[model samples]
Target: MFKRLILFILLASCFLGHAQTYQVEKGNSKYNAFAFIEAQKIYLKLVEDGYATTEILSKLGDTYYFNDDLKQAQKWYAKLFAHYENQVTPEYFFRYAQSLKAVNKYEESDVYMVKFNTSKGFDARSKMLEEDSNYLQMIDFQSGRFEIANAKEINSSKADFGPAFYASNNQVVYATARESGSVLRERHTWNNQPFLQLYTADADENGVLGNPKPMSNLINTKYHESTPVFTNDGRTMYFTRNNYDNGVYLQDKTGTNKLKIFRSYKNKGKWSKPEQLPFNSDEYSVAHPTLSPDGKKLYFSSDMPGSIGYDLENEFTRSDIWVVDILADGAFGAPRNLKDINTPGRETFPFISKTNTLYFSSSGHQGLGGLDVFTSSISPSGSMGKVVNIGKPINTTYDDFGFIINDDTQTGYFSSNRPGGAGDDDIYTFLQLEDLREECEVHVVGNVTDHKTGDPIKDATLVLFDMNNNKIDQQITGDNATYTFRLDCDQSYILRVVKEDYTSNEEVITTPTSSGLMRTSLEIEINRIPVADCDDIGPLLDIQHIYFDFDKFNIRTDAGYALLKIKAFMELYPQVSIEIRSHTDSRAPDQYNELLSEKRAQSTRDWLISKGIDASRLTAKGFGERRLLNTCANGVACSSDEHQLNRRSEFIVSGFGEFKDCD
Candidate 1:
């Protein structure tokens, strides 16, 4: 009976799996909620039983998504459209095409790319599709032979990371498990036992940081209180806390509690009043609280119910990030799962930039082993990018955490406890780069010096950009903000300099690579400017074209128009990666998007890979939100324009990566 019922759900849900079957049949929710293993099994059974339909295939894709099974998801989604040949719905065609690309099936996936060119959501999807990879996919392993910070004899020590900057105050706040121990305390995997704490220090806009000191106990909990952030005024502080109340310690011990967030205030020459965050819970847990630069919103991690199709009450859930806006009355609004940015694997430690870019940590997504940093961007109209991994130097076989940026200056901070650290985690500083972005050959070199002092700007932000106008590399100048970058001939470059209170200066250097690599760097002079200079122009995108292959539901050749635009964007930004979103037009089964979009996004990503793009830089997804685009979803009375727009494949910049086009 159970197998039969499971079979039914598989047919009903489609894209099924063996490992996830019984749970779907039982209907018991998960703690982290990637997918009910049972549900996954039932879905898989249907596929094995020859009951697979476009709809069933889509559900199976969805199951893979929740499990962070990008490859499997990509496979099912591809099978649907890869061989598709017929007048199919726009959503399936576009989405299936993209899914094939995401898994590096580029040459094969482009076929379905044509349908998306004229799809309804082309406008929104274009912006994302036309993006490229940057340094933000900083997995330490990818550094090739570059010595890791933890391996270098330099400043590796303590549980250091999570650098938050207060531009107005010229200070930084971060978290470290360096507190309360001779060496760092052992990290408890299951419960994340409370050992981390908050700390602060002085930082120059140039990226130079002074020795950090522990935050007063008023804000740092006896247990763990890491990931500190502050308001623009620097008065109010928001932080993530692991407490006795939040039952993280109860692993199999079976205690009923939850993880939480806390806030504090500095008053009368002293810090006081540490209070529990009101929205936290015992069912699901919340940690790593980060506030928007404006202090009007709060973002954090939780295993809470309704977050990415999971229930936080269970013990086995993987952690995903969630966000809540700060209401006018200073109250926190209900938490909402950052859907597009998160998946079945774990998404945690979210950080946001003034540019609507995001940074976070994840274990489920592809990476070295321990956690790695990932990024995404929120589009002009409020959509998000598919989460992409930060590769090389910044991330590694160990864990990386607390990624924060000083927007205008292109400087950033994060922490790690890789083998070479002094003890646990130690804070490390880096700068975002733009000019001299090519891997080798001729390079551009320059210095950011004090306009009046003539001294090199130590730690001043030096950003290097590519044609797409986004930052590709970042590092603090050992002496001054003086920096150098290697570039290919014929590629365009942009470099910017910024320090707190100092007016930001950007220089553009376009050397014809075809003319051979050349060396050039003009000094950047900065004067103190108000943060208002961070003004943002709305992003624009055009849906180029979409295509499909013979008999495949996934994309194939001929999708180049749309894919190249994405490639062009990546070439331009150097610091950006895209989240290719796939969808199925309403003509197919409702469950198709889960598979179709997953396949399409992945296919689009894979195509880019074939084009020499990095896999870590792209994230693929299937929204099945065909519900919103399908005028037939609610049987709404709408125009063909609206309906068509909804049945398209799209892309979004989901995170702050090496490709920020800094001005």
Candidate 2:
């Protein structure tokens, strides 16, 4: 919902044929007006009355997804996929993946991810995923170079983002949806949040922000105002606001007010009223402004159509970064889309650093997930270099954008919703630790090689698993057979190695809390598991362990991959019949653990059957808490790692004559 300047939607009454079409039409009108809550109620009522048309089903999913009701979104999205599998679009596939990830269904999400990539192969969304199949592993194992903390003094329990450093001053300006002290209470229907307004705060020498207050009333209005930018001389400022002039507001035929860039002058210590920019219009939005270092050009984002490389039939409409020449006479030239940096997906929140580097956020680029911040060098001729994602601890599977840097103090701030935060969107500060060498931080450097011949292995997938057996990060070895990862301190890790037709390997390594940032070298020696090993098939196949999330029976992505290996082994020795045994840790009561283990056993069998194994070739059973691999009994206190060793599933060869056991 952040920086969503494009609120244009059209009603599709032409597709309605049921008796409840009138109610659905009313819902569409509410949806166009951004009244998502009212629109959701009407859509739900229609569904309850047996109106499950394709349009209504799609609208229901959209409402919940945009409202951040990820669980509900997943439910409706699943139903929609089951009913209209042939007509689903790439956008729906992307949204379905997002919702699945939110609910920790990473394996199922990957299933949709493959379909989306196949359909939209040329989009950045597909290219990014293809480039880094193990991005999650890389993000989880990172021990960040700079220490990050929430800007507590300058934040409120509302949506706050888009932080910009004031020109040559310690004060920082940002946008927030928090209510001002006044009585204006117009909430955006897309989200029930209040309209955004500009706020400023001062940062002290310690880089702590405090004493935030609203900006001049002349700049803040009843409509939204955000993304403030100031000139180098600090005499003029530029910002984004709704298309409201004097006492009347200009809106498109859809009754949606478009955003426009405005300028304000500061004279004799007071800010003047804002004047609408000449290039603004009521048809499209032109917002999120940033100026070049020399003040010769102004950059912003807009969806005015005719965008470079945009296709109208693609269904994925997004804004492109546009720039205009700011002439010396204080006039603006025609806007040109930044083809080098912008993609078919949304790219906004432009910031030009002191070193002539352009920093912005994009959903179209290859990233961990969601909106990721990227950097590109701006040449003296205003051309852009290759854009690269500024990877995690800073970026995550959630939205991370509105990045800014301060070269004067070598300190900067950005906004994110990754895990722990003060609000929905919190501003975090980063101080470049110059004294601490970047390469000296805690890390793991390793090479994957064949155990038999000592030859370097390329394209080998290496994953880092935490002490509790959760997959943290992953990387595929390059031609040099090398992989490096910044690791968290004082944590134990299991390096998992998997390659085609080779036995998977797991190596345990622990990092000391006092270890300075330096490379911890490791050599992963993986050997080939011959087909003969599958004959006995009782833990000798070197099959990797099947893991699930805490208190869950569903398979994870890593576990799903591991199961495929087991299925292949079964095919290699078709005469061998196997019994599937599942177990649970001693955390819950005996009855509950027994039921959970049974469900897990059945789930494992179901997966194998789906992989083309005969159902009669396997027998499912659960051991519950009766099987303790460690000393963690009922009353014993143990670490999560110790307990995880007990929650496992194993396949035991029951007989060599599978014809007798055949159904």
Q: Name the top TM-score candidate.
A: 2
* Cα lDDT, model 1, residue 236: 78
Mind giving the per-residue lDDT tens digits that candidate 2 earns over 1-663? 433433321123344444477898999888768777788899999989888777787778888776655667788888889899678777778778766765667656766766786666556654445444445554443325456779977776777888887857588899888875777568877777788889998988867888889999899887789988898888899999999878688998767888999999999978998898898989888999999888888999888777753667653347889999998888999999899988766788898888888889876665655677877888988899767666656676677788887767768888886667767778888875542222223556767777767777888898989888998888887654656666767777888888876777777887767534333333444443342312434356566467666688988787787788788877876766777888999998999999999988999999999889998888888888898888998999999988998888887767766523322
Looking at candidate 1, what is the lDDT of residue 632? 57
Alpha carbon deviation, residue 209, candidate 2 (Å): 1.9
Residues 1-663, candidate 1: write the lDDT tens digits: 999999998786753454345434333232233333545666676668675666556656656544334456678876665444344455555445445544555434433443443543442232222221111232332344222233122233444566777547377776665534464555433223336666667765466777667778666555666676777777777777665543334322244445677777777656666667887765667787777656677888887767552634322566777878788977777788887766544678888887767789875454543467877776765567655565657765556777776678776777764555665556677665531122323445566666666766766777777768777876456422335555666667787777764567777787664523244434445532212111221124345335443213454454676677667666655556566666655445667556765676677778888887878777766776543644456445666555555545565665547323222
Task: Quote each prediction's TM-score.
Answer: 0.42, 0.62
Error of 1 at 91 (Å): 30
CA-lDDT, candidates in order: 0.58, 0.76
Error of 1 at 606 (Å): 56
